[model samples]
Target chain A: MPGFAANKVENILDEGIEKGGAKLDNKQIEDVIKSVLDTETGERLKIYVDTCVHCGLCSDACHHFLSMGRDPKYSPAGKVKRTLGEIFRKKGKVSPEFIKSASIIASTECNVCRRCSMYCPFGIDVAYMMKVVRRICHKLGVTALYIQDTAHSHSVTMNQMWVKEDEWVDTLQWQEEEAQAEFPKLRIPLEKEGAEIMYSVIAPEPKFQAQLIYQAAIIMNTAGIDWTMPATPGWDNSDMAMYTGDFEIMGRLKRSHFDTAARLKVKKIVMGECGHAFRSVYDVGNRWLGWKRPPVPIIHALEFYYDLLKAGKIKIREKYKKSVTLHDPCNVIRGGGLADKSRYVVNALCDNFIEMHPNREHNYCCNAGGGVINCGPPFKNKRMVSNKVKADQLIATGAEVLLSPCHNCYSGLEDIIGHYKINMEIKFISDIIYEVMEKPA
Target chain B: MHDLYNFVRGPLAWTAFFIFIAGSLYRIIKMFVMIKKKESFVFTFWSWKYSLRSIMHWLIPFGTVNMRMHPFMTIVTFIFHICLIIVPFFLFSHNVLWDESWNISCWSIPDPVADIMTIIVVLCIIFFLVRRLKEPEVRFLSTASDYFLLAIVALPFLTGFIAYHQWSSYQFWLILHILTGEIMLMAIPFTRLSHMLFAPFTRGYAGSEFGGVCHSRDW
Candidate 1:
């Protein structure tokens, strides 16, 4: 017991948890936790709680635990023991301090990546438990400020980044014109009824990464694909509400997203290279809406790229001449099963492709994926520190460039590369595809 | 001593077996009914194919990443579970009990093989106890109930091994074995040992979600 200390990461006082906790009483917290457990949960949650034997096999599956010096608290089972286990043991008679740490452990510490589920002897979905904890936190007004703010933006604007309606349309037009200068006929079609595909992107694409939209336009036009982007609220496919555990707002956001595609009469919804958003539309949000599946069939961009390249819709001008390793985003690879597809797109785009040691569905999460990074500056150091395994994984691949197909992964890997001083450039698959694909002259 | 062993093996044994069967059924049915009430879609999405595949993979030793990561634990756990079930059902002695009680019995493992398995099980239980004590992650989550549950799982095998070897006080060990076995049977529904009862369904549901819904392998 002597000389034991956790590596210090400065904690920032988050107003979201602070303000929410300040307003809450123990009676309200107990009621919220009890109600969510009794009513919102089904056998999945109950059986998982009962079934885990405390074997701790899931510890290594977590990047947080592996990265954080093998700390017990960072382990998946450890986190659940602290949050859900304690709550159930006490029958929801927990204090605000308990709720505050529980919120952090559920929302920020764990990525809900489902990697642990794969490793568990029972295939217990710890992520589902974390989501339940997050839901209770949401109900009791104790969510992370940054992600909660994004969820607020989702409720109001149906976008995480809160890009205005005109701004959304303008970004598309601007990217369309930029691509037009090279292709001379490229158009980022907005709200074209009966289009074969509805191309949706997270609002951040328009807000911060508009060039990604421009690159997508070039690829779509080069491939002669019929795609439409809505000039409305549902244009952004990302739902921060899902991460915030505000399921009501998540349902509303998903409804608007699906309703938009149906109104446009698009055949399928093709989402951009964002992991959590893909999870929202393709898995979580649709389920919450009581649809067995997305009413409009959804294709993650990894699949879209694979389909395009396989069909010879897009021709590579020249393969990228750098050694590259692929970082499989947890949501798309593990959650969506696009590992092989993403690899296909990468192999087509690059001259030299390397595989990370535990590639495919077995890959580790980008700590940034499950809204952990979006918990913002308060947890940035903690986020980077919790990504030590990832930084090491990236360094071990010894590739000149790392192709992360998801937006969150791209940024997350970039931070890891910088933080750990790993010498690798990070990029999305689209970045390489657009670079090498032939543009119409 | 003989009468005590007879009582445990007769009435106490039957009572323990009855409780195990009835309580397992009650818990299973209750969970299914509760799931139907709350998340009925579990029924819609539940696939026999994925469930079987998922359960099968997990059943294999070192089949999952975490299993491979902890090969020692995996091998020990696989041995522990296999020996635990096999030594009871296929043991030459226990089958004799079935033969005496119901005039029906299954094929029995040779006495020597069953004895080796019993020793292996006792050793595995020791490994589990040490790991639970030494591993911080496990220790942090372990309650007094957890430790008690481990002892409950360990004792029957330990007592059985000593009785089978005809160690010092074998008559006493024999009765202890019967009592411990009954205690284990009775504890299955009421303790963390229920994992054995519910693992298949939990694994099945997760397998279905990943395979049927996400087109992914859970294991």
Candidate 2:
């Protein structure tokens, strides 16, 4: 009852916000805010702030505003006006309480999904603005606890989940041993220099979902692709620091990940089904490190699966029978542009494929990403309430299974489906692909 | 009274245009310089194909999902913009002034049609003002500057309408129209009206990212 009651109420008391709030004096907050606004932001921020007429045309594009009974503050323009707009108006002379709410608004309220950007006539990216507020929050040391811990992990160990070096190698060997049951000769290659493909994944795969690694190994072996995963800290391609506003840690994590891949001398890094990690490595991280593109070319799993299926490297033995729908992750579909390819793989693996309305780039965010879920348990119910639009989108599909290719989307959709009691089971695309693909005999 | 009217419609009008054109160029070049200093990579990703594609979509009424969804706003916005630009440039009286001033006149709409367009613009401004006040989502984002900007935009039209229709104090309305028009023109570069200048560039950058980099259509 208490657990249910907590879900009914919003998370008003968070240790990270409260503790960070306690230490932040008005002057400190003001100085940090001023420093970020002047130096850290670029032409993009300057243009966006000047161009947004506050026409409120983007009101419908945001999932949070729509789901929260059309709350005015949830509107993307309103959120910016209250937080960053206030900071700008006052010339960074805002209070600690204001910083606390701004942190909550920036970190938990927005997914920075870039969905709203598409709707603006000028294509004003409020997500970029929210991230600016987040950068200010991170500087103020008021980032939500769980996500901050993840950033701290990235700084300390170069991975999000803090998987130890031995634990990582152990997990790979363990998955390799588990997967060898199907093919006696199959191996999850670890650190083979000059391997054509370096298969990279988020830390969560090794930390909690080892079976996905097992599944990936089976696919790689079946396709006869020569791939190697690093045994060191760089194996994790996810960077929570990118979302937590700690760009310094994000730059470090990205550099290490690329270095590990380059050290292997792989032709390309085949990133696993993790959207945010792919974003960090391919888009945001590279830009921060002064590269227009990733140092090592990285392709997301959605596109990787498409290539495998299209090339006849992986053949299907039998298609999945259950009627399934696809949840397009924002980072991949919108950010990475793997929309058609994802459908290509899904249709290849499943007999019955149903398309969710507003599919592809227009898909609503899972509400778990952009460090929203990384803000952790305290904000679970808040997200559940905010993602009612997503729940409705899923429920309308009336599918038996939801196939999400991105790991963040999978977990986020799981929470939505369970919270709404939508009578749909969620599975990764790899799960369905592994089930139906022809294996080596 | 005659001298004030001549001064407002002549020298003040030139001053207003001077500030509008020079200030806009200054703002644009300043932004480019800032980009060069901080984030020059903006130059690396600009795609003319993507930029044109995005601008075209937004230009066409109901071409985007948001525009299509809010049919009333879309129609009002498109009509408002068309009338705002068309009437001022091609009105018969304005063209007559150009002919008198410089022996140059291209085309002019009949005064009756111009009158209808002017009234339509006034109604559209009212609709926007009412929406700003009535819609809570919009109201929350609205600032004093927003309302002030709206009034400044409407002033030239209102005064022009009165002067054209030969309402009370025609000389006063004529002088006021030029003064208000000058104020709005000069405000364009300094205030949110600069969006008219920045929209193309911002939309181009976003379109470049979405199309060239993300391989997706922005609109």
Candidate 3:
């Protein structure tokens, strides 16, 4: 067995231990564990725990294991054994130190990517197991500082980036004005009641990548789609809280998002290119909020672009001339099942499309989603090292431009490419579509 | 000794069968009943078709998903499970016992073919053991129970092979084989061996979730 090497960097768990350890006694820990294991988890958890044979078939499916030189600790099954299995074996009599370690293992180590679930012969959702560990950690108040802060932002600002209400509206107006250079009367219509689509985006778009909003406005205007962006807080759809195991805040964020759409009375929600945000609305948050699905239909930008291109509303003037490859965002491709539609949109807009090996749903995660990157600057080195497999995959494609639709994937790919010194430019799907699509004369 | 052997071969066997069936059914029911049902938003026309396809994709030996990722293990596991089921149920000796006990018999594999399958199963168990010992990742996840399960699985076949070859006291070895077989049957619902009973449901449910809930392609 590989021993846990003491790293020089101050571990994230120290803070969790200091804060949660003072607040929680052993009895409190046991109470939390008993409640979660007994009430929150159901037969699915029981069955998965009982059925895993320790076959270790899922080892290769994880990028962490691959990138970390096949270290056993990084293996998906091993992570579960160390955390959830240990908890079950101990029956909740674990110490503060153990809980701190478990919290770190659950929050920072595993991305909860669900790739391992694909490889499991018994189809055990190991990500669900990690989520259970995270839930326990959340109850113990041991979540990572950066991600917990992001979750706090979600609670207070209804956005991941803490964009204020006025700043959000101002950013939209600025993007709309910039986009009017192409179509002079283009508008990012705000809260247009009974619009055909309510276009939502993550806070990072307005805060950092406002040009994406500009491009989206151009596409919506040129295609003449009846869409509206909300001026208020609910427009940001990304949910770091969902990743941080703060289901209460996640539920609130989802309710606010859906309520905004309901108030606007849009037929459906069309969100920007963000994978985790798509998962939040379409699956996790909706389930938490007691809806079988989103109250209104939710379509991702990949699907939205596919629809527009298929309907001949968005016509291409020229094919994207650069040799490009598509990185399938895990949530949208595997979790949401938009792989085929995403490919269709890419093939329609790009002249030369080179596919990464193991493309589509089988593609590796960018190591940024699931709030791994949101754990933020303190863990950047760890993130880069863990993404060496993805770096190699990108390099092997030999494509000049990598088009990843998800914002997290884009940021992660940028980090890995820079770290590994790979010569590649990362672009989003809309970037190419906006470039190639015919503009109104 | 005779009474104990008779009990082990007769009432004990029936007890194991009942426990395996009842325990498995209880587990399956508990799983379904405990999890609250949420609404499904599977609106695709191909939902059921894809669910069935996903199940088949994993079910078929060296299926598309397994072939790409785990061709060697898949082949060995497929063969091992087939022999594990077929040899126990359809061997001529087993059917002869059934005929003697219950006035019922079924078609049997030729003795030579059955013998070859038993050997294959023993080899596969050895392979699994070696894998657990050699692979750091596998070893890290494995516990004493895992090795014990493998040993129990291999016990009946090993003792039965020795008895068939008349290498020692056949009567002693025969009793041991029957006792080990019954022990394995009883262990099925309690141990990781529960996978034999639970795999179909777990794998199928995973398929349905991906196909019907996530609307994702299986392979």
Q: Score the docking of each candidate (DockQ).
A: 0.78, 0.80, 0.58
Instruction: Output the better candidate (1/2) by lDDT.
Output: 2
Clashes of 3: 0
Cα lDDT tens digits, model 2, A312-388, are 99999999999999999999989988988998899889999999988899998899989898999888889898889
Candidate 3 lDDT by residue in tens digits, B31-109? 5566544112222212456557766887788776645677788888889999999999998999999999889979999
Best by DockQ: 2
Query: What's the residue-level lDDT of A228 in candidate 2?
Result: 95
Each prediction's RMSD to truth: 2.0, 1.7, 2.7
Q: Please provide, for model 2 over B128-169, each residue's C-alpha lDDT reduced to its tens digit, 9 standing for 90 to 100.
A: 999999999999998999999999999999999999888699
Alpha-carbon shift of residue A325 in model 1 (angstroms): 1.1
Error of 1 at A3 (Å): 11
Candidate 3 local lDDT, A231-350, one digit each (tens): 888898999988878899999999999999999999999999999999999988988887877898999999999999999999999999989999998899889999899989999999
Query: Best-fitting candidate, measured by lDDT?
Result: 2
Badly placed stretches (over 4 Å) of model 3 are A1-18, B36-51
> For residue B192, what is the lDDT in candidate 2?
93
- Worst 10-residue lDDT window for candidate 3 chain A reads A1-10
- Compare candidates 1 and 2 on TM-score and give the better one: 2
Off by over 4 Å in 1: A1-11, B1-6, B165-171
Best by TM-score: 2
In DockQ, how does model 3 score against the reference complex? 0.58
Task: Please give me the DockQ of candidate 1 compared with the native complex.
Answer: 0.78
- Ordered by TM-score, highest first, the candidates read 2, 1, 3
